[model samples]
Target: MMAPEDAALNGHETDKISVLIIDDDSQVCRFLSKIFTGMGYSVSHELTLTQGISHIFSGRVDILFLDVNLPDGNGLEAINTIRHHPSPPEIIVITADDNVDGAEIAMKSKAWDYIAKTGSSKNFRFALERAVEYRRQKKASLSRNDIRREGIVGESRGILKCLEKVAVAAHSDIPVLVTGETGTGKELFSRAIHACSPRCSEPFVVVDCAALPEHLVESTIFGHTRGAFTGADRDRTGLMKIADRGTLFLDEVGELPLEIQKKFLRAIQEKKFRPLGSKTEIHSNFRLICATHRDLEDLIKKEKFREDLFYRIVSLTLHLPPLKDRGEDVAGLALNHMKNQHGANLKNGCIMSRPFMEELQIYDWPGNVRELFNTLDRVCAEAGEGATLFPHHLPEHIRAFNIRHRYAVRQTETPDPETGSFEGPLVPSEPLPPFKDHMEKNKAEYLGHLVAVTQGDIKACCRISGLSRGHLYRLMQQYDIKNNADS
Candidate 1:
């Protein structure tokens, strides 16, 4: 390592900025290397793309000078590979070819700059300075913008109501149940709620219930004492204890086994629990936020869920809608997606053609906002400068989607906010459907279908079907789905 004083004197020191040069031409590499070295920039040169990739992983390279036409592989291929690495180095394409097409593709792939190999050394130096300056500004913005979230963009009434609920829930220690379809930003909502809560400074932990192994569920959640199990080599803290005085987000909470649920419920209710193999109890304080796409009511009916636990945890609920319902908010959300994928500097710089917007607006995003964001990110990555993003810019799967529900409106059978249990006195239908008596006839069928598709996961069913858990419970009572006492 260079001494501190020496490093400061040599402005081009590796500690200041590391540059990796990839070019098949030896003379060009040698010439640029001399120029950068004279300027005090620590530089490494690779005559092949393969060696360049190895150098990227082997050393700390801040930026890449990649030749578009390499001996073994194309620069675009290298760019794609580099992007998958952590803290990917910025790339500047150096090509001798006068092909604007190649330069356009390079820009779309997020190259910092594109310069012909025949360009003057002065031109190369200028491009290098510009790229480095741009990188510095972007890095600063990223640090400054840390407080803002990239996903979950919306300000429409429906979205605003959901945000209000989340904010209110964050203020209390009450366990909040977030119900939303897959890819509807439940995790993002959980993070936002945590950020707003008093425990914001503390660690915010997430328990992926669905991904936890069945046998290890107890140890994972409650932790274990040393020598408690065959693999217990050391004492470990459970997620609940680790999240003490913070927030614990239980994602896919419905997937938690009943045995685990029993213990988890006790922890939530008392904020104290004994770890496995330990006689003494440990105390914990965490604001619990449980999110799931399952129907808790149906699960309770089937005895697969604990009713007392449900009542205790679900003091408040926030249901997020699928992207399809949010009117013109789609366009605004799409633009935000573009900005995140590119950068703040690229906002409103590229326009999505009207045809593209029309297609996007009409499509039923089954995966919700997440799918939309991913699609736009990919499109921007492939779209060149001055490029008008038409429908073709979208992935083939999205463009080829049959789109049967483009004009279809959701049909709601139950009242908008289905409140009250089956025990409550019935309110007669305002004057019924054309089928008269059959208006209330198929209620059980609808509930059964919802419950089945969700695999008895009540919360998930409620989110996808757009029905409240309370409403689901009433429907179950009327349908006579047998109750499972074990739950």
Candidate 2:
């Protein structure tokens, strides 16, 4: 038997494809295995249906040739168990008894193709080639969706790992639970996952679980029949049915009432639910992706959330780090948003001075990406006409927040080589020299602050600081500050 890892890598190799053979006839397994092996393919064969299912879950097979009538049991019995896997290998039924009903059942359960065992090697080879081609196309479609929405742009190690997991989980129909502080772009990530999934063309529905009333939660998610409740005048489909064959994003999912948790669990487990006051169950296929800013484990411990539901919905969990923790991404995000928002205004776009960018990078964004966008918008709006971005464009809160961070950073007081004590230039405790001796120092600090506050518009900085244009140039030269603040 080929190793699982070796078989998985077969898709990339020329003249190789991972094939799993399932048949009660030892001669048939040997015949197919020999034929496939001669074609430079990696093949695994099992005489029993149970072992075939086990090998499929082993991640060693790309394609399965299952016998419809297994000695142990019928292939239809194992369809549900196979579909439950994160990445179920593609299956092609091979049976001596050819029936339209069996083929329909196999296809409905997501089998790739169904072929009768006519004992023809040529026909088997053709079926194998077709399955490979279909899987290849499916993989390509998934790749295109991943690059869209600029999935979680960041350089931080923590965020990158989260993105890697998202990519792996996207290929599966498993439920995902995303947790983070408020404004952490949980919704953005959820949308990206859905877009990159096989159901990309379908609707990506969102439910604000926090906004729904406790009594109306069931009606909102699971719909209601006509005359089911006091206000129910007509039949309605819930988010689950409406988002059928797509994705359902439950934002602030922790806010869902304890009583509703039980119903939600059943809906997810069976992928079918009855509308309120309805006797018949409605079927809907949707990928569940839930987000919450609250600690769910704590809620579960406190008897506020169902532990069973939590496990079901949390097949994969992604905990996003706050914007403050994303280090260098802050400045990159600002520039990206600025370009995206003010493309035509690029010529007048506030060229972020290095000092201002540095300050923006260091400040903690409590509101995360949302706060960053708001701050950038404020800065762009407040800038003078024909002006580029500057510090003055930012809101008072952000400016003050940055200033506090700067003060805190300088509090450490890095040592200077020229001085015996750990006193450095720009240290918080040290006083700047008088005008004559340290004129350059004074000029640099004053002009730097002016540029940072005004967003690097030399003219605006000169106007606000009451310094002449010529004086600004002279000051820049004296302080060794770059004059291209408008760049």
Candidate 3:
């Protein structure tokens, strides 16, 4: 038996290993439950995808046996969210479909195993035992490896998953491709990887492909001889040479010129390049890391980017979620920013009001973390010597946007007096409800419709509603609404 503290450090909470079976088939659940029980493990089962997710969030679940098709939604779609769980379980995708595509998806999603539900009982048990053994070894490894996150904030599941991947990338020399929307901290992750890698002490060179002058792009990366070009007054070392035995981070690699892309691909593949006007080739050894906000696949389809270069850079991929999708991480990010920007103010007892934090959480930050920090800086300046921050401290545009969205939601929910239906225009004679009461009613109705439309898929609900998982769960509990519309 593992100590509680040790288990927690390994992302588990229970002394004994726990397993969860999330399949609607009663016979399947009973069968799996017995197998787990016989292995001296605790087991639980949920008949719907929604309940299964709820159970995972509410307690400790070390291993999950997930079904592809469920009563509420497709279980495969929930793998991303489950992988981000605070104490993520090792997922074993169990399905009767036996579709080749589904198996590919499950493996890509990082599921421990993908096996047909119709497989023999012995096969099933073998999978479980192997998965459990892997978990044990992984936990032991995790208990000893503490990641050093440089200036990265938020302990939300999304951020945690990213950090876990960062730790994995740090130990390898593999080329890494980090993708995310603008302002989502792609460069920060790249730097973190470099900082944790074996070459941490070496120089970490950066080449801003988007900022390089078109004519000088080649000489800038591969160096230039004294007489290479008109302006080549003296010998100049390129970024590639400077990054030798270190890390070479290509920021916004998508912006590389087509000709430059061809040269860069060869340089990376061979670790040797000929500087301009030089008859001999120079050798440089460096680890590669790239960051991009654009869809390289689409770029490849459009022929704007080379297909070979795309594959060459993405040996490992890490995606950073948008701030809006991070849920409660906003609070931690805000606090961390405040401490760095206004440490003295914090020491003086300045605090954020609940309404202020709620307003922050409700707004969809288009600029992500960078925008949030900028907004907070402005708010702190405006607060001056105030003891606490309030909703009024927020930028006017943010407040205005929330007001308009709320009103729009209300209008969408308003009904026609005569027809008593939402499809018709509201009657002028009807009185408007109190602001608080109207908002409360509309919130419930909106959530209900959201669940119905998304068919109880939590991922869809989050995307559609722009709510974080924790925030959505809290609202569901507050309103006493089930994740499924039928409930």
- Candidate RMSDs in order: 22.6, 12.7, 20.6
Which ranges in model 1 have alpha carbons more than 4 Å from their true place?
1-150, 342-351, 381-386, 400-487
Clashes of each: 12, 7, 0
Using all chains and alpha carbons, the TM-scores for the candidates as numbered come to 0.51, 0.60, 0.59
Q: Identify the candidate with maximal TM-score.
A: 2
| Model 2 error, position 48 (Å) | 18
Ranking of candidates on TM-score, top first: 2, 3, 1
Q: Who is ahead in lDDT, 2 or 3?
A: 3
**In model 3, what are the clashing residue pairs, if there are any?**
none
Q: Candidate 1 lDDT, tens digit per residue, 1-487? A: 2224323433433236678899999999999999877866778899999999988987678878999888899987678899877768889899989989988998899888898888899987887777777776675455333333446677777786676566556656777888889988898988988887789999999999999999888888888899998989999999988999899899999898999899898898889999999998999899999999988888988998888788777777778898888856889888776666655334435668888888898777898888887777656545644456766566645654523243122222224445632332335457545532453454566666666677788766555444467976877888775434215
Q: Write the per-residue lDDT of candidate 3 for residues 321-374, one digit (tens) a residue.
A: 999899689888887877777445444445788888889988889999999988
lDDT by candidate, in order shown = 0.76, 0.78, 0.84
- Model 1 scores worst on lDDT over the 10 consecutive residues at 406-415
Query: Which ranking of candidates, highest lDDT first?
Result: 3, 2, 1
